[model samples]
Target: METNLNNQISEEWTVSEDAIGQRIDQYLSHKFPEQSRATIQQWIKQGYVKIDGNDTKSKFLLKGFEKIHVELVLQDRTEHLPQEMPLDICYEDEHLLILNKPVGLVVHPGSGNPDNTLLNGLLAYSSEQKKLVRAGIVHRLDKDTSGLMVVAKDGETQQRLIDLLKEHDIKREYVAIVRGQLSHTGHVDQPIGRHPTQRVRMAVHHKGKPAITHYQPLRVFKHFSLMKLNLETGRTHQIRVHMHHLGHPLVGDPLYGNPNRIAADVVSELKDLVRAFPRQALHARQLEFIHPITQQPISIKIGLPEDMEQLLEDIEYYDDLDTFDDQMDVEYVE
Candidate 1:
């Protein structure tokens, strides 16, 4: 482990993008062509590089045309710390990538899941710079929600994707088995923020930012309903919060829903399928966004998991299926 005092590297560049606003780490990645991500992460951790002298969020918006300054510091070792992990890569190209994130895989490390997160998997997968953490994580899916996600390989493309998400230009939709038989179609518009008494849970609070979830009920069983939900604003726990606020928390949600709420009739019919459906019954079913480099629309669809599929089969077997059609069009509008 050798170290060096080449701890300061300085550069200045002007933002050329109108959409590339606040995500400074990503912006500078494009601006500083020769500098690698390993150097950027080191700079970020050392408080050397900043946007307008203020440290900014990785997901923060970028306002283009700002004259930015950067300072970089080199890590002690530039060698790759490699760990072997398998990934189910869906699509891959020079600028963009897509992966099928499995359930129980934490997207990034936190309190309980400090090691072996999706980020760690990405680190092992990255054949690029050795020390950068923000290699290509453009967005994230909750640990329990299994499905497809897109990642950016470089800084310019990453900023464009982030900007698209912020502007609601991108589209993301989810499917989940939640409690109760909800209306055929409805939208929940509520502001979600951290709970006052319990920090872990989210609630509809006046101080929280605006959150909207449009749901179309697809099927109904004795008690539970399967619905497709579309997000308007990307916020933490937005779908779950909005659903719970509507008195229909997702089935098997340990954190927010009534765990024992599965009605006897529903449970009796789902005896075999119940064990398979363990976690919160949510899956990111579809994703659509513009290709930043190609400027063409890309849409990908993932079918439901075996558990969800089995659960629905049982629902149909138990009674005359009063399920609503799943053939409706969903589009995002302001």
Candidate 2:
């Protein structure tokens, strides 16, 4: 290993007989366990790695006893500025923070949204969190999906939390209003892929990754149902895609649901209420995970936001009316 006085670290590795026919990226990935193989491949592609003093590609096949040199510089990710904003913190400790993110709050800065995000707010909240990448965000909730998310206070905690998520050790439950009545507990086990033609949507395809959603009907209404959902895997838009595949897309889901047709299913008085819904009626209602630092368990539960609560009330009212009409019809027949 060699070290420069500046912020870069340069190291050398000798390929053993066992590593003879491996690709350069694979060899380096084995050498450095902490860094992701994708990161290492990016570094190699950018000419940060050399085999026998010559710049080589990631797929360069190695022979035994070849000397490989690597130069690494910690990534600088402070391009985004911090902004002062209010946060709905659920729990906080030295290692992590659990918070309820409200609707319309983007989790991170993206192409259209360059600032004023949860990441920006977290940066302004604490200096330690500011230094970490993406404000130490471990997982993400869609901008319209309001609910619990955990943020790490440091890098180690962030990695551990990520590992825990990959292991499926973290538990997440959601509450959503979906179209049609579902009376029984259900599970959706399907593969999800990007839409073939519709780029913004996800669909079920054989080539896609495995995704599962478990849901139980909390309340069956006239045209819509309140559901309690548990996720076995957290793929992008997993619940939305699975529900849509089941022919019962989430209420108010503009991308995958029949938002426009929702008004037609309800009565004349409730059409306006259905049409006025802003976003998907999905909320991360509960989150349970083991603490990375404290080695303790944590569980959090949040109630439905006011808009969803109002929507449920409307569903119940219409459902009651539907039941009454059925009863009246039965009496008339008798």
Candidate 3:
């Protein structure tokens, strides 16, 4: 057996004949004394552990001579610092707090992003929030996506909410501006997993986890559409990937959108708005779920953000011009 400790954090190890057949997480627990089995399992689940250059589950049985690589960010859990940041509180109670998370605020601390996250903000928002792991974050939105999220104030409520999410009882709805017009409702029932080549991105793969996204056209423009979407199965970047699969990527999505492919003949005003747009044109518009502790139904709705609202106006203006052109063409033919 060969053991290589890269630094105080991260390491590589070759599975030994004696350690063969043991669960990967269990093996790591005995190898790394500083971390617990649960922490090791979490690292595996989060794709921090790789066996023979591939991500595997915690229960994977090690084969002798297999190479294992692990990123050791779990050692830095204490580095998260509480900071006083503005939190848009939509609803709050002793059991939970529903917040409208602003764009650009990371939900939790991780490698390269060590401080000033929403988790830190929640820690400072209330002392009781500190008691819950990850500030009771039951779900997450991308750092650039602005919208609603619920934070549990206690352990019991946190677990309850987590279970509710697993059961798919929590309803989450989003609004987005896509690059092309969509005439009717559509659903993308595809699977999503890590991109095989681009490690940082996600892609649709047959072997990946199931992801279902249902979208309807709320308003259509000549070159853009306002859409409302609901998720039946949550996967990372599910909406963005599904929309891209449908060939109507979100207007401002830097990852999945092809900005260069935007129609060349678009009105200058609408084009300018698209160029000025900085982030993805996606927002969590509504959320409905049962209160974990109170055992009552709850719902919340919010309108588009300032940037999205402005972009919608530009789309409408361009659409009006197209309508006028169509009418003129019809009259000229007569």
Clashes of each: 5, 0, 0
Best by TM-score: 2
Global lDDT scores for all candidate models:
0.72, 0.83, 0.81
Which ten contiguous residues of candidate 2 have the minimum total lDDT? 325-334
Cα RMSD, each candidate: 7.7, 6.9, 12.3
Q: Residues 21-59, candidate 2: write the lDDT tens digits.
A: 898898787676445567779988888998898888888
**Cα lDDT for residue 311, model 3?**
81
Clashes of 2: 0
Ranked by TM-score, the better of candidates 1 and 2 is 2
Estimate, for each residue in 1-334, the C-alpha lDDT of model 1 and write its tens digit.
1224564556666667865654666665655543555555556666766667676554557777666566655442323234567888888888778888888898766798767777667767875423333556767888888888887766567667877888887788898878777746889889999999999888899999999889987666556678888988988888888888888998778777866665666545464455346788888888898898898788888888776676666665763346544454422111
Residue pairs of candidate 1 with colliding backbone atoms: 21-62, 21-63, 22-61, 22-62, 22-63
Query: How high is each candidate's TM-score?
Result: 0.74, 0.76, 0.73
Sequence-dependent TM-score of model 3: 0.73
Please write out the lDDT profile of model 3 over residues 1-334, one tens digit for every residue: 2333433356787888998789988888777643446767888888988899999998898778999987743333334578999999999988888999988989998887888999999888876565456877889999889999988886667777888888999999998889886757779999999999888878999989999999887776778878889998889999999999999999888889866568888877778779779888899988999898788899999888888888888777665434433322122100
lDDT accuracy of residue 27 in candidate 2:
79
The reply for model 1, stretches above 4 Å from the true place, is: 1-30, 33-82, 129-133, 264-276, 319-334
